[model samples]
Target: MTIHEIDKLTGQFYECICFKPEHYPKYDQLQELFYGDGKLINGNYDQPLEFTVQSYIQAIMHQIDDGNATFYSQQEISDVTEVFGKTAQRISVYEYSFTAENTAPWKRGVNYIQFILVSGEWKIVSMLWNDEKEELAIPEAYLV
Candidate 1:
């Protein structure tokens, strides 16, 4: 049951960020999945960019408003999750596209997500992710 709930929460995490041109992104829903003071980190560059939950939402909104990400969708291709007591973690392999109907993703990446059981509910406490670059390809094992 714990794993199931975690999976559902992760699914919701992805759902909140995806949107088509005609639809608004569900970025606000992210507040429900994150704990107080939850953070997200983007480690794709030389220096990691860290954000509080609200800041993360604002950043994505800015991207959309700037027309940089007018249409976007992201989904998990694979994940490995481990649970111990009230704390759990997941290494999720994901694929994303900027096009509305792309059969293949334009990019792939990995996310390290940390969770804690709070009041019998699983909530994301932190997440760090890095996109796959030309020199830093995702390993075959992670893809499977």
Candidate 2:
């Protein structure tokens, strides 16, 4: 598939996580689109933890119990590069803004995501990201 197509899928995957407040996470969608064994790293996590998309969405659901549900307003992909081989890799930089009611102001972050083509479709294999911080910020070129 083309980078453009993969970028669209990435954005949709995030939308599934942040925008579907009216229902339980569309975990089945994630299960098919992501590697059954995926890994995620974020600010709260101490290490890159491996998980099935089902478990990952379950974790997100737990956050909702605390009245936290972030919805994204914008999503941008940059620095896309593809390496076609036995396991094709599509890597890119992702940026987005999200906010939840009664939470801090809208926060933005730059992240690195890597996808591999499995069973003829792109599946996120691993990802790690941090909210924009004083020491490390999204580069100006990627701010678009």
Candidate 3:
């Protein structure tokens, strides 16, 4: 994707996570890329991934139980940086994370995430992370 296109798509993704109240309206679109073609699953190897996706969504919603959902809105967006080159299609992987002040202590951990250009827009396609441990370390560059 052109830098401009990537920027626009990246902004949309962040906005959806941060400020959009109509979060579920785009659920199908979001899931299509992340879970499409059974990509989130592994008929040959890993366990079914539907549970993972459901659990992930549930964890975020748990923040809403105590009125903490707005932290997503207050999240600091990383600069719109990209590694652009030609491989197959207009694909770029972005890394971003949000640290919630006053988050449930049990929920603290860094997320390694990636998004992809599905048809003409970027969507989160996969994410993996380590468990929350004592002394969770934020990267030096990410400290604001």
Best by lDDT: 1
Residue range 66-132, candidate 2, lDDT tens digits: 6676454445555555656524443345544444444644456755667777666777777666667
- Models sorted by TM-score, best on top: 1, 2, 3
TM-score of each: 0.94, 0.70, 0.41
Best by TM-score: 1
Clashes of 1: 0
Candidates' RMSD to native: 1.3, 3.7, 7.6
lDDT of 3 by residue, 20-122 (tens): 3334323333443443332222122245334355555565667755556544442223432444442112222223334434454323333344555555655
lDDT of 2 at 29: 74
Better of 1 and 2 by TM-score: 1
Model 1 weakest 10-residue run by lDDT:
97-106
Candidate 3 global TM-score: 0.41
Q: What is the C-alpha lDDT of each candidate?
A: 0.91, 0.61, 0.42
State model 2's lDDT: 0.61
For candidate 1, lDDT tens digit of each residue in 1-144?
999999999999999989987887897788889999799999988899999989988988888889888888889999989999999999999998888775754799999999999999999999999999889998887776
